[model samples]
Target: MILTVTLNTALDITYRTAALTPHATNRVAEVTERPGGKGINVARVLAALGHESVVTGFVGGRTGDALRELLAAEGPGGKAAHAAVSDSPVTDALVPIAGTTRRTIAVVDETTGDTTQLNEPGPTVTPAEWAAFLTSYEGLAARADAVALCGSLPPGVHVGAYAELVRLARAAGRPVLLDTSGEPLRRGIAARPDLVKPNADELAQLTGSREPLRATRDARRRGGRAVVASLGAAGLLAATPDGSWRAAPPMAVRGNPTGAGDSAVAGLLSGLVERLPWPERLARAVALSAATVLAPAAGEFDREAYADLLPRVAVTEQSSQPEQESHATRQHR
Candidate 1:
């Protein structure tokens, strides 16, 4: 079973308003909500692929209850979430100490198909709360086949949280997949996770370089066994211990791009846990990410797009790491 840990979960509210303008009173054409956070999205994708996954994270107040309801043992979309080590499905009753669980508002402009996001600062995690969560983390990772420590560390939490999680997963003999941005990625790399899924910007933040391959290699050198970067429209740039490969979508459909990276992580980690080969795993990641862009919902990917793109993905292993950066920018129609 796959174990996912989300430090900061939320009731993601997405609105579709045509021609969204700042400070204007706009009527939403459509709206949807989901149990959102990097880890939760990953879990959702896993469930979609018929994988058994257990999600453990902080939940409080009514929003927390809603999240639990959505991830119920027999919840919608044919269930498969819940069923964690803890009985009664573990959504630990931890207070946020300030605001409600973060509410991310995605104002998707219907006219342009562009999405503008408004993110909350997220609930503050007290030191005591942090310590408590760590106890849960250790317990969860210890018995899991694989653990995914994902998303950003909320306020009041230490910056090195993912770093510590990497250590815990290693000690428990479980491969850890760390996915986050900025400092968390940097600190987590110090602990040397089995894999990291960083998009172009996060890769830049880690290596301070614009070159994707160079940044990826630097991240790997810093202790990541592999660095898989989501290169926007170009596709996925991955450097594993075995070798490197690039995966892209087929020249066909296009749509929303929200939560593509999270979907990619889910695809890659799920394959890794299944003991699939490196090329197949890379292809799965690419297919799933492309699917995500095709899905209209926020933090959700179109499953059909994934099916269509799977066979078309190409994965090639490089004989050696390049000394200089390769300016190859290939795109699928």
Candidate 2:
């Protein structure tokens, strides 16, 4: 089973309207809410792909209750629940806290297909609550085939939270994936996770380089065993010990891209557990990310779109000449 950790879990609210105009009252045509966070989103995608996934994170207050209810409603036997592709179960193991969980708002413009997101700061976690979560995570990590430490750290949580989690997961003999940004990401990578998935902006923040290839390599050097940089419509650029490769969809799919990165993380984690080749894993991730863009809400991918795009994904080996040249230049210097 895969384990996903979302320290700052949220109630994701989406508003759909024909168009959003500045300084004008907008009429919303539709509204949807779901349990959301980087790790939670990953768990949903993994479950949809037929993997048994357990979601453990900090949740509390009314918003937390609602999030859990929504999650349960989509799990087995819930009114809105449906059988997973492989009938795999998604288990919720969220820890409770005194503080209220956060809420994220995504306003989708139907006309331009653009999204404006408003996010609230998560509840501040007490030291005692943080300790409780660690205890829970230790138990979950032991049983998990792979663990994903994802998303932002809530207020009052230590900056090195993910770093600590990575170390714990490693000691437990579980393959771990780290997906986050800013200082948390910097420290987490130093913990040397099995994989790190960072989008273009995050990559730039880490390595101070906007060039995908160079930035990816630099990120790996900082400590990640492997680095997969998501390039949005350009697809994924991956650098691993086995080799390097680039995966892209045949064409871009237009829709909400909110949870696309999380879907890619799900694809990569699933592939890792299944022991698929890097190229195959990259293909899966690319397909899933593109399929996510076609879905109406976050964390839901269009199954038909995924199936149609899987075989068509372009996975090409990248040349290592750039690295070799960099090495040569360093030697001369």
Candidate 3:
């Protein structure tokens, strides 16, 4: 089974309104809540795609209890279970803590199709709780076909948490993917994960370059076995040992972009375990990302949209000659 780790799991709450105006009260038309955080979102997508996925992370308090209830309701004999019994299920293996889990708010403007997100800092994890998590993670990693270490570190958790997890996953001989930002991302990449997925802004922050190609190559040099940078509506730019390629959707998709990256991660991980080619994997990632945008809530995608976009995605090989020349010129100067 694919294993996903979310250190700072959250209850994702979305508010939909006719329009949003500054300094004015807006009338909400709809509200939706779901279990979220990067890894949990990935697990949901993977499970939908017919892969057995286990989620292991930190969860506690009332909010945590609600998240687990919602997650469980998606399984067999639950209110909103999967339509088909053949679909793989998402098993929760989350460790408990004393602190309350966090909640994230996303306000969607139906008129402009824009999302304003308000996120609360997660609960502080005590040393004892952190230790408990490590123990749980070790056992889960051993049995996972692949592992994903994702999202932010909660307050009081060590900055090198993802780095440590990456090492453990590697030692267990499991292919691992790392998706995070800031210092955690810096250290995690150094652990040399099988793959790293960073958005354009995060990539630029890590490499000090706005150019996608340059930033992606630099990220790989820092230690990722492969780097796939998400370019928002432009699709994905992948730099791997075997080769490089750019995958783009047939057209831009308009909707809530939240959890789009997680869907892409799901696509990539699923492809890896299925032993699909890089191009095919890129195509899948691009299609899934676009489809997620079309979905109403986070951590979910429109299945019909995904099927329509899959075959239309364009995957083109990128040349390294220009990057080589650019590096040589910089050295000469």
Please list the C-alpha lDDT of all candidates, in the order they appear.
Answer: 0.78, 0.92, 0.91
TM-score of 2: 0.95
How much does each candidate deviate from the true structure in C-alpha RMSD? 5.5, 1.8, 1.9
Report the error of model 1 at residue 317, Å: 1.7
TM-score of every candidate relative to the true structure: 0.88, 0.95, 0.95
Look at candidate 3 and give me any clashing residue pairs.
Answer: none
Residue-level lDDT of model 3, residues 122-153, one tens digit each, is 99999999999999999999999999988999
Give the residue spans of candidate 2 off by over 4 A.
81-86, 329-333
How many pairs collide in each candidate, listed in order?
0, 0, 0
Off by over 4 Å in 1: 73-99, 321-333
Total backbone clashes of model 1?
0
For candidate 1, lDDT tens digit of each residue in 2-50?
8888888887778888789888789998776667888887887876776
- On the 0 to 100 scale, the lDDT of residue 158 in model 3 is 96
State, as a TM-score between 0 and 1, how close model 3 is to the true structure: 0.95
Q: How do these models rank on lDDT, best leading?
A: 2, 3, 1
Q: Pick the candidate with the highest lDDT.
A: 2
lDDT at position 143, candidate 1: 80
Once superposed on the true structure, which residue ranges of model 3 sit more than 4 Å away at CA?
21-27, 81-86
